[model samples]
Target: MAADDNENWEDRPLIMPFCGQSCWLVYQTLERALGRSVIIEPGLSWTLVRRQDPNMEHLAKITKCNTMVVLAEKLIEESFDPIVDRHTRNNMIQSVVYNCGSNFPRTNFSRFYTAILENDGRVISAASLRIPSPEIAEIPFIATSEAWRRKGMCRKLLEAIESALGDIGIKRIVIPSSTEMLAKWQIKFGFVNVDYQTNKNIKELNTLMFLKTTRLQKVINPITRKTADLNFLPPSSPRLPPAPPSGQ
Candidate 1:
């Protein structure tokens, strides 16, 4: 997606910058094009999960020989790349997107997203997804690490994911629900039972379809320059409803 001066970012990154075709390409565009995280609220910030090295140990645990403070060169400043060009910024942006296949949602799922609220400096919240076809995508979970339940963070996370999905031209999303939460998923979240077309695609879905889980899906409105303008309105500032019973 092209970056222009007139871009409205009130519900951004969540609304997805440069949202267009290809889910994987959408991920790449967000990292390189947007390259910034949104502070969702006073205390919460939204970002892709940070990627960490598998072999590295704790900072204090590293021996002086492999340490930072007393390193041979001026290591602290050396650690940061000089932002000389697009290459420098692009590399920096990639570090924020998590890539651990071993994590929740697992390796088979292609993309991982998170809704993080930093407290005293730490990141958290999560989701994982797989794109079975250009028109259909499957999501495994959305969760937060802190006691942020009922605070609308999950909605914000879903908005962000939906923004990207709609941007990439993915027409619908499928999520699995337990029988217990089916009502919440259907009524509260606006999901409905799978129809014939989605069910027809099941053979191609493989293990992406969870066993015994109630299937839920929501049709996405295709986002474009026109419709995207309304993408990320906050809860307090929703689009007005129609006037009713005017002559009753």
Candidate 2:
């Protein structure tokens, strides 16, 4: 969400999904107090992509970059906070409240995984999952420091995130890319472009991509009563099961 001061955001409202109801209410209250126009800015458009294959676990094992991938939940469990400053510097909180609300400890809904170089113990790359609904998870941020780019850190973090989600029965993931090259690069990792549109406010094209994991398939049974197969349907389709009842 951070941009150069010279760039104009067209005075649009910022649209970000919170990980918990409390954070959502807090943001809403803040917006009401400060006015939506002051809080939201429209500048960059991002492409959305998804992946569901646990087989992608191999990508998480890349050792050529001399870094190790670990779940942020584990770090929190051990009381690690050195990387908090790094996340702050990157403006991670402006995009989503991953560090607040129900995600404070570690829940299946909002989890952050990171990559760190062994030699210096410095975090090089990271990605977070925000489950807006039981049926969908969004990766709002997947960042690698400039010094770590082109070293497979981002890919490692991505693979780790997908593998972790698959382990817990998450079958869908959504990613937003800011550039065509980034969207194209994601295709190699199993994402497919499903929609494209031009954002008049940002003056950029936004591509939406998705992937259905093969691990868990909904099998509807007439007698047994099971969920229907509405994978290809839109999220709001009536046939799809209602979102998880939990606020998180």
Candidate 3:
């Protein structure tokens, strides 16, 4: 299908940065572009968390809901969901699209990724990496389907995106979260709360977090090319800046 044709299937206005096709196509594009094979186990099956993988093990053991983490890196291709009826899935997608707004085409510098349930080709979670400059990339709109909560899908999607970004030398990640829970989760994943001054355009509900792979205390200005403390902000300081002009 043409890229334009797939726009309607998206839940939000933001354009996905990778190949404008299925999640498998995006995965393949990342692998080829980064020159590293992307390996994600296929299937929605469950497995005992290995003791060596303490983080997963801890999460698996502590959850009160008893929802086992679906043990897969990527969803299996062309699988079908036995439990979710077609009507329910369509309604869920429609609700998400309605709430998320009109289609916004992606730019060359930005990339998008998603985690899907192999059964029925359902997108369980998604993320975006926007490269405003060579040294910095912002991760926006990390969302998971309501019906697929606590399944470890978001975590896997994040891991895949971060790994790809790191491999390509984009180490700093700017994430604007909409809730305290999300902020705490980002912190747990190594992001630090910058607590920068709030942008007038952003609602009071959101919080901003920044993270760097290296210990360097300085961040270079994307526009000026001058190095400054990581806390620096542009004059506009409009929280996370909106996506660039649609056509660029």
Candidate 4:
């Protein structure tokens, strides 16, 4: 969490335009350390919005602005290094709105989770995901500014996201991928192609996935961060007394 941003988050249900929610400030020891406030300023961070937050209109207003599409845009494209020096509301970690990609527009933006990196105040790299079901989480999009690519921005965000999700009791993560990038995603991200049958077994997957996209999955245990194959097969039924003893 940004040091300056932390000092101002009042002890109330404050609206965090950057984080896209009106949740209470996380001030306690174990809780704040375990939640989304784990990341820091000038680097990796995440913004979350749940299903029925009170600040939905505020979120829509900020996200609609094309202002801070990169680095950090605080309503007017300026990076306030020392937020305490400024008069804006206290937000734990400030990040401008960035929602894009194939499946992003289709899903309810109110439920998206974002990981972003900013420089000065502009968002240089970012990615997003949604929790359609407890069985799996889907990363619909990830992008880095052309100038910021290849510097490991997305990788850092990805790791942070996996850890955050694991802390929330979500153990599996998925991404909708293209055929050409399947092998590369597997090698670089520890993901495997979720076969068509397995995909169907996870019913909620079909709800949010785009057509013509390949599904890939990875299991990050938060503690172990281990890799595993897809496992949605139905339990096998016991044989019925050897077919009634050959028809008696």
Q: Pick the candidate with the highest TM-score.
A: 1
lDDT of candidate 3? 0.35
How would you encode candidate 2's per-residue C-alpha lDDT over 1-248 as one tens digit per residue?
Answer: 11224323344345223433333332232222210011011321111111212335544323322122333333222332223323234323322323332433222222222222221344444454453333334554456666667866565555544443343334556565545445444565555443322122112211112232111111112233222121223322344332223332
Each prediction's TM-score against the native? Answer: 0.52, 0.36, 0.37, 0.52
Instruction: Give stretches of model 4 more than 4 Å off.
Output: 1-46, 49-110, 195-198, 226-248
Q: Write the residue-wise lDDT of candidate 4 on 32-124 in tens digits.
A: 221122244454444332222225645653442233333332321232222221223433123213332233323324434454555554566
- When 1 and 2 are scored with lDDT, the better candidate is 1
Q: Considering TM-score, which of the candidate structures 1 and 4 is the better prediction for this target? A: 1
What Cα-based lDDT does every candidate model obtain? 0.46, 0.34, 0.35, 0.46
Prediction 3 TM-score vs. true:
0.37
Per-residue accuracy of model 1 over 30-124 as CA lDDT, tens digit each: 33322134555566544433232333554322332122112211221232333222333322112212322433322223243333333333434
Q: What's the CA RMSD for each of the models?
A: 17.2, 18.2, 16.8, 18.2
Q: 216, model 2: CA deviation in Å?
A: 20
Weakest 10 consecutive residues, lDDT, candidate 4? 20-29
List of clashing residue pairs for candidate 1: 20-168
lDDT: worst 10-residue window of model 3: 44-53
Per-residue CA lDDT of model 3 for 110-226, tens digit only, reads 132222222233345544334433334455435566667677766665555554444444445566544545545555565554434312212222212223221111122234332
